[model samples]
Target: MLTCAVPTTLGPVIGAEQGHVRAFKGVPFAMARRFAKATPPLAWTEPRRCTDYGPYAPQPGQLDQPEDSCLSLNIWTPVGADGPLPVLFFIHGGAFVTGGGADYDGTFLAAHGPAVIVTINYRLGPLGFLQLHRHGLSEADNLAISDALAALDWVHANIANFGGDPDQVTLSGQSAGASMVIALATLPQARGKFTRALALSAPGRNIMSADHADHIARRVLAELEIEQDPSAIASVPLPNLFAAVERVGRRIADETEAGTVFGPVLDGSVIPREPRDVFADGTLRDVELWLGSCRDEMVMFLKSTPPAAMIRTSERNLRVAFGDAGWERLLACYRGSVRPDENPYEALLSDAFWHRPMADLARSHAEAGGAVWLSRFDHRPALEPFLSQGPTHGADNACLWAHLPDFIDRPILKRKGGPMMPADIDVAARFQTSLLRFVTSGMPDVAEAWPRFEPHRESLAIFGQPFQVVPLNEGARSRLWAELSA
Candidate 1:
């Protein structure tokens, strides 16, 4: 592998080059003590080797025994470019708990689009999202979001040396990361940081109210037996802290039927207001937006659920989300619309959690005069793991990255192992090309065929074998939500 060095704001860093793409891994953007706000890493006069990934945030069941100094980012840039290229800043999604930037290899996308690609690692689980301001630890709340802001600030100040254009950055993320993208786009601090945003499979209701966050924090403190001395939480052992987080998280999921217990909180300081309201109120009117979700988003969560338990939980959650009168009507609509092999409850939850919210956000952005594009990933790879179910959560990653080996080799998307079919390559090429166009330009189409998602038309591009554009479906489920909200 060829070696090179780029001078960043801190100092010079060594990276590895392979063919047309150069990769810089594990470059620390910021550092922080346990549960404290992150600060810039100490400057190094020597050429630091950034050829390998850095440590990830401490969380339950992580392999690397995560460290507090996990605020690092990886960069992939093309070898030969005439001028500065657009930047695609991505955040990985493991429900805001178990993922790091190392999981995503942006070399392919960087080489294909010839655009700079960046992925970051941030604090996670209780260490990242736990609310501690009420307990006198004001700086500890929303540490993960602060970590992200620091990373972005680093890129804006330093990406030009890596052949990336600082003015044309596209902020993008998936799942929990997608929610962070939404939060960052609406944040006053994140203004002028990026020109465009792309969010995939962002949960509709992931942001916790202040009361809900305080309640969860109290539960965590009590679990650790530190309710009396909340400051002692900083000294708790890693194992004990993670154990408390898991127990409290599971109990909350059981009670709320929500998949995650940790997420961005409306702390009135970091995230001042609801993100949905920000979208509707035209706060992001100047930023371009692209949003997407898989067809069967909830199947990944419900696949392991027992039939009786799944039914009971889904019904109860639906009742709570849509109230009694709207729940029955929504259930009937899903039963009539879902496929024979599909579960109605899963479909309803998928819409409630991912699809509906994405569509609504896109519509609101468009209505607010922001340019928007909407899409749904419908191409199900001809793999054994996905044979029974349609395109489930995280299925789009395999195609988007154009690397099927990662998906087949690992248990991601429930794949034990499988051969890469011809369709996989074809779909991956199409997906990557469209995304490349979007990254380079504001538009997401190779040709002028794909239409913008206007409020009246609400055109949605379906990413299937023969990529096509169609109107967004506002069926009985959407109507029910609209009526209930009204």
Candidate 2:
């Protein structure tokens, strides 16, 4: 095995060469105690071997053992870059409760972009996001986001050694990770760290209010039977803490129709306001952005939900999310747009939770003078588990990283040993090419083909067999949402 060594600020790291890329895995970027802010890793004089991945944050059903010292990151850089290459710093998404940097292998993308790719692990679930400031544990606020920032700081300082341009970093993520991308773009701490952003399926409205976060924390404490002594939370067994998280998460989801209980909180300090508000107020006008979502984002969740419960829960959640009259209007609009096979509730909830908010964010950013590009992933692999679901959640990921085995093995698009169809390969190529162009040049395509998203026109690029640009809010459902917001 060919080995390559790069000297970082802390020490020398020995990575391996695979194909046309050099991969440095399991590199410690930061360290932190349970619920504490992350700190830079201790410096070392000798070279550290980073051939394998690091541990993920503690969560139920994870194959690898979880650890508190999970603030490591992985790096992949092209073998023969002409000069410094742009960096793609990605955060993984599992609703803020699961996923780690190890899950994504950036080797293919690194070689493809001829750019440096960095992915980091952060605290998850109750350990990372269980806000306890009101309960006297002030350090527990936004630890996960803090971990991400520390990783970014490490990359900004050391990635130059790996042939990455610090000033050309593109902050990117999907799902819960996408939410963090939006958070970082608007955060004061993240300013000047990255020049561009790419968010996929970002839950724009997933942020929790301080009161709701405190309530969840209180519920977790009560479940742990340590309501009087909240600091005891730091010492709770991993299994016990995760159990409490599971219980409280389910209860909260049932009560509030919330997708996940743990995420960034409006702590007035760490994350002062909602990301959308920041975009509306033009704080991120200088940052270039490429935002996108799958056409059927919620089918991933809908497949698991019983049809009856899906309807009942969706109705209750819609009523709670939008007022009685608004709920009626939303349903009416969605019914007209939904296909015969699609569930109206699924369409309504998907728009209410994911797509519409993404459009609004694009509009807000564009209106504020930020250069923006919006897209929708409409290509689905012609195979079982996928053909039935259309372009569902993670579908875009599967296509974007079709060269990666992890994405192929994703349960969302399990190919069952079948080879990819010609269309699948074509779409993957097109999708990756567009993203690579954006990462390198800050624009996905030619101006005429992929115009900058405008608040007045709302152009959206559709990624499918035949890629096309269309009006973002042309449909009745989108119009209704615009009307309702107005």
TM-score of each: 0.93, 0.93
- Total backbone collisions for each predicted model: 0, 0
Clash list (residue pairs), candidate 2: none
Per-model CA lDDT versus the true structure: 0.81, 0.82
Error of 2 at 203 (Å): 1.3
Off by over 4 Å in 2: 63-66, 138-140, 257-259, 305-317, 320-326, 382-385, 404-407, 410-418
**Candidate 1: stretches off by over 4 Å:** 63-66, 138-140, 256-260, 305-317, 382-388, 404-419, 446-448, 474-486
Instruction: For residues 174-245, write the lDDT of model 2, one tens digit per residue.
Output: 999999989888888888989999999987465778888888889999999999888898888888888888
Q: Per-residue alpha-carbon lDDT of model 1 for 1-486, expressed as tens digits?
A: 746778999999999996788999999999988778999889999899999988877766663554657889999999988659999999888877877787778888898888999999998888888888888875757889999999999999999999999999999999899999998888888888899999989987647787778888899999999888998998888888888988887677666554356888888898888887898888888888899888887777777554323334555766886688888787788888777777887888787767878988898888998889998898887664465667888777757764543343332222354556777777778878878888889888843688899977889888888888887766666676677768
